[model samples]
Target: MADTNAQEDFSKLTADLAVLRADVAKLADTLTTLARSQGEAAADAVSSRVRQGKAKAEATASELMDEGRAAYDEARERAGKIGGDVTAVIERNPLGAVAAALGVGFLIGLLSRGR
Candidate 1:
């Protein structure tokens, strides 16, 4: 009778172990599926962000280019007006212009010697 009881206990333990193994296998399969889904989602999110960043960079670059062009045009106009004023001044007083140029040349020479 004791030997028969031991056999029954062993059978019950084996059945329990089999059920546990099946449960573990199911859990591993579920985890694998979840990991795959999460990876795809992350990739999609990164791709979308990259596209948005590229578009924003392009727009900012275009805006900066337009601003730079406007600034250059304004500077050119100012320079032209200054040139015309200098020409008029020289025409009105040639002797004064000669004296001013000599003074500027002497100052430049002195500065160059210091350097």
Candidate 2:
């Protein structure tokens, strides 16, 4: 009777160990799957943020380019107006303009000699 009882207890212990090992393996697999999904989610979120930042930067650069073009146009218009006014003054006073030119040239020559 003692031998039969000992044999049965040994068999029961062996079966419990097998079940425990299977449970541990299943737990490990679940943890690995969960980690993989979380990593993928994080990567997707980072990519989305990068795309949004790129779009915003492009829009800002476009606005700056437009402003630069407008400033260039305004400067060119001002230069044209100033040139027209100078032409009119020269037309009104031909001899006086020539005298002024000679005076400027003489002053520049004096300044160059000093330098």
Candidate 3:
């Protein structure tokens, strides 16, 4: 009974993660579109209004990119920490750690291919 519940919980979490990933991808596409449009307008703008808008958009895009990079850095740091912990655990139990590391590496490689 507990195992079934755990499996269901994991499935729900997996689905939620997938949805979050999709949302992030959609947001990235929207930002790209917005940046391109703003850039084109900026090229033609002679008046103050167009210049201002373009400036604002560029600033916003820069901020977003910085935030995204920071987030990625943080995630990488956390992943490194987790990997270190896993290595420690593997040292304690060599066989299990090796199997777990292989599984994790495979999944990571698969996921990294799309991006």
Best by TM-score: 1
Worst 10 residues of 1 by lDDT: 106-115
RMSD of candidate 1 to true structure, Å? 2.5
The C-alpha local distance difference test score for the whole of candidate 3 amounts to 0.94
Query: Residue by residue across 6-112, what tens digits does model 1's lDDT show?
Result: 99999999999999999999999999999999999999999999999999999999999999999999999999999999999999999999999999999999989
Give lDDT per model, in order.
Answer: 0.98, 0.96, 0.94
lDDT of 3 by residue, 12-109 (tens): 99999999999999999999999999988887675678789899999999999999999999999999999999788888999997898899999999
In TM-score terms, candidate 3 sits at 0.45
Q: Which scores better on TM-score, 1 or 2? A: 1
**Cα distance off (Å), candidate 2, residue 44:** 1.0
Q: Write the per-residue lDDT of candidate 2 for residues 18-106, one digit (tens) a residue.
A: 99999999999999999999999999999999999999999999999999999999999999999999899999998999999999999
What TM-score do all the candidates reach, one by one? 0.75, 0.72, 0.45
Which candidate achieves the best lDDT against the true structure? Answer: 1
Clashing residue pairs found in predicted model 3: none
